[model samples]
Target: MAIKPAEIKKLASLSRLVVDDKTITDVTDRLSSVLALVDQLQSAQTESIDVSRPFHIAQRLREDEITESNKIDELQATAPEIYNGFFAVPKMID
Candidate 1:
């Protein structure tokens, strides 16, 4: 499955990639090697295999905890504008 120079050119055109002659040659070589590897894989044997177990391992639950935070009055005191209990900001865009 050797990739051709013409095919690489066509691929570059379709992909909208600007590649020089050297890059095209390199890409073509790499593509050829990848295709050859795929062909080799297609011809190999894989009769007994369990492909699902590894990807479906049981997950653990996260622990819930009671947390403490600063009071709103203490935080709003640091802001320039505080309407009731909320901080106000200038309107910029809709």
Candidate 2:
């Protein structure tokens, strides 16, 4: 399906794009080519293709374990203010 210049103008207006007269033909040709490629892709034969199998190989994962000890007190020691184990910031609104 080829895109018309009038449709391109409408799309440009709807998208708030500033497409001049010279570029309208170029834009129409590009959009028409893209639509033609989409049409070609839609006509592909894939009836026997299996959807259950994955295209990529399964990745190996490591066991989840705690590697570091909690250092909340050590980290919060540098904060300017702390309230009930949480950082306190100045109120910005009433």
lDDT for every model?
0.83, 0.90
User: What TM-score does structure 2 among the candidates reach?
Assistant: 0.44
Give the residue spans of candidate 1 off by over 4 A.
44-94
Taking all chains together, each candidate's TM-score versus the true structure is 0.41, 0.44
For model 2 the local lDDT of residue 4 reads 96
Q: Per-residue lDDT for 22-78 in model 2, tens only?
A: 888999999999999888876879888887856677778888988879999999999
| Candidate 2 off by > 4 Å | 44-94
Judged by lDDT against the true structure, how good is candidate 1?
Answer: 0.83
